[model samples]
Target: MAGHKIPHFQNDAGHSAIEIGVKEFMCVGANPPFDHPHEFLDMGAETEKVCPYCSTLYKFNPALAETETVPAGCTLTTEAA
Candidate 1:
């Protein structure tokens, strides 16, 4: 997992819950400039998890791509090293 490109998402739209494909990902409260600390979340054996930083709930969706989100615009294109 050293070179894995972990999917990162942001909730700029302030959605109460977001549907994502990947069970493991990073939740950035909002887009940079207003974003909270990027928190890595994993939903192992579960369908959903909540971000403690933003209190945003994330639901797993098998129908979506690993880098996709239900409402869209939640996937962060640019990532930091």
Candidate 2:
């Protein structure tokens, strides 16, 4: 009896799978969409500071004592914290 050699399989699905894995494994941290700020600034608001990178709002209180400069273009308004 003689053994037959099988050829390697090639398909678009395999290429797509490899591409997706590479993209997912890539270190694309803080690249886009979820832009993380390097420095946090306190706007002196009642208890919240707006993130400049992602434009997401954050809150700080007197208990934490975490003071940071508020980003530019943000208004400081005092409220009960």
Q: Give the number of the best model, judged by lDDT.
A: 1
Candidate 2 wrongly placed segments (more than 4 Å): 1-37, 65-81
lDDT assessment of candidate 2: 0.26
TM-score of structure candidate 2: 0.28
lDDT at position 57, candidate 1: 93
Model 2: per-residue Cα lDDT over 58-79, one tens digit each: 4433332212212221222222
lDDT of 1 at 35: 97
Model 1 lDDT on a 0 to 1 scale: 0.87
- What are the candidates' C-alpha RMSDs? 1.9, 25.1
What is the lDDT of every predicted structure here?
0.87, 0.26
Go through the candidates in order and give the clash count of each. Answer: 0, 5
2-76: candidate 1 lDDT, tens digit per residue: 456788999998999999998888988897687997788889999999999998899999999988898987998
Q: How do the predictions measure up, each by TM-score?
A: 0.88, 0.28
